[model samples]
Target: MRGTIVTLGGGGFSMADTGITPIDELLLGLTGKRRPRVCFVGTASGDAASYRERFFDAFGARAHASALVLFGQATHAFTAPQILLEQDLVYVGGGSTANLLALWRLHGVPALLEQAAAGGTVLAGISAGMNCWYEGSSTDSFAPLAPLRDGLGWLPGSACPHYFAEPGRAERFGEWVADGTLPPGYAADDGVALVWRDGALAEVVSERPGGQAFAVTAAGETPLEVRLLARF
Candidate 1:
């Protein structure tokens, strides 16, 4: 069976509104196997330690059947192919996207993730986690410090999280799109998520009332426009 991918905006844990229900539905849709195996990667924030607790708090007793695995260090060879082989979900955590990608690639985790996903492992991530799938991104959180780092490219374009919070971020995103430095993509606000399946956007969901998504593309030299996606 084909699996599902859930990418979250930054501040997933603190966000008052997290569209985790849709993610749950997607996971249930993927498999009916009891006690699904789940793995987490790249949490410099120390959030992975409480993943199961937080999930149970948010989802209640229904989360009991899920098994959570965490890979917290910056670079470590994930030696459990048995776990990878049997995992139903592989989740990446939020942190420095550059560092996460570097560590993941250095440890050859990305290729392993691809293999797992191709083999029907449900893939999900939040914040920097989500950013890992895109080719590149405009993130004040990490990009300014290390511009040369490449993302995992699980998807075909760029990803911009915290899309509306930062000043002039929209303008910067447009510039990158126009210059062909980044591909056409979606910008996600907190509490909102864009779901991509089989290399295509399947749907978007929002738990917060004010979040909006932007579709950006190059219009002309030194010009770009940000338009709201009607679907969201």
Candidate 2:
């Protein structure tokens, strides 16, 4: 069965009035007859406390009581996948994308994630959490460091979040897209969410101060033009 993938901006969750907190809507959309088994991965912060207080506050007792909150720094390589396999909603927390991806590769998490998705699990996350799914992504949040590897091949191209908010980010993204360094993909700002279902873009929604999503393709032989899509 095909599953849903929700990509959020840097902020963890958003409010419906503001239009940014699409998580609740995403959850509502995914829920059918049963509650999904949720799991959070890449909590290198070691504890839920290190994450944004809003997460715990928003999720509240629900998050505190989650069955598995895998702190990447503390677990062994072999233990992660077993827990991942049991989850129906796997929410990857934001951290160092390079480190997270490295550890995931080392521990066989990617294959497990793909397995989970194939089994109809919902894969969702914010910032690095979302960036890890696409091809090349800008690590501007953790800048002074170089860009890392192509993301888990769940999607065919690159993803740039907090795209228009950061200065020169859009320019850098344009350069990369034009240079053929990264594939045609998206650029999301604070409150917008880019959703993909059944291997195609199903929706792109805005909340609060909205941002843009671009589809950059090689128009001629070199330069890439950023093509925009309708808001979901």
Candidate 3:
């Protein structure tokens, strides 16, 4: 089945107090449901209570929002995989990609996520969350913002989130792709979402002005057109 993935460099409810934004609005729209079942995967943030609160405050009033809290693997009626499968949309919160990867693997989440995507669940995230779907990405999970080459491989090539908002991200990602430490791939600036549909790039959208995107290769980097959301 055709599925969708929206990889945002940054922006969304995570950035604002009210958490309302065009990007998040678009996510809900993608689900094609009235008050779709939305799940917030905050594993990257260690299932922090504050982050969960923020997500609920932003989405609770609209969608059927819930946070799949995995901390300590607390006893619950449903397993992590089951909760993930039931969502119309899965929004991952940003945090340490390295830790997120490790924990997810331990809990058998990768396969379920793959299944969720194949089943037409709209998967989206920012920063570390965005980095999880690709084969590799530029990350701050380690010191010096290194290239993280081991990813889920759902999409081809590598990826780098927060390309403009963070210092040295562009430089390091460019270098890594050029030197073949990572494959030639895509990078998204703050407020930009590199959307992929059915395994190919569908469009590049931005929540604000001045946001850009790029296609990075060993030869060089090329600027990609970013469509500013009308509501923004």
Would you list the C-alpha lDDT of every candidate in the order shown? 0.59, 0.60, 0.87
lDDT string for model 2 (1-232, tens) is 2567877654444222232244444543474424456665644333344453444344544432142344433332323367777766777766667777776776677888788888877788777777888877766546552355467857657777776666776677767767778776677776566777866777776554434556655552222222232324
Clash statistics: count for each candidate: 0, 4, 1
* lDDT ranking of the models: 3, 2, 1
Candidate 3 overall Cα lDDT vs. reference? 0.87
Q: After aligning candidate 2 to the native by TM-score, how far in Å is the CA of 190 from where it should be?
A: 1.1
Writing each residue's lDDT as its tens digit, candidate 3 over 1-232 gives 2589999889888887586699999899999998999999888888877888889899998899987767854432233556888899999999888888888898899888889888989999888899998999998888679888888888889999988788899998999999999999999988889889988999899988888999999988899988888784
| Full candidate order by TM-score, most accurate first | 3, 2, 1
Worst 10 contiguous positions by lDDT, candidate 2: 220-229
Candidate that would win on TM-score: 3
What is candidate 1's lDDT per residue for 1-232, written digit by digit as tens? 1346767664444343543454444454455556565554544343344554455454343333332233533433334434555677765666677766666666666677778877888787776777788778766565462222277766767777776666666677777887777887667766566767777676776655555666666762221222222321
| Per-residue lDDT of 220 in model 1 | 26
Q: Which stretches of candidate 3 lie above 4 Å from their native place? A: 73-79
Output the lDDT of residue 175, model 3.
94
Candidate 3 TM-score, true structure as reference = 0.94
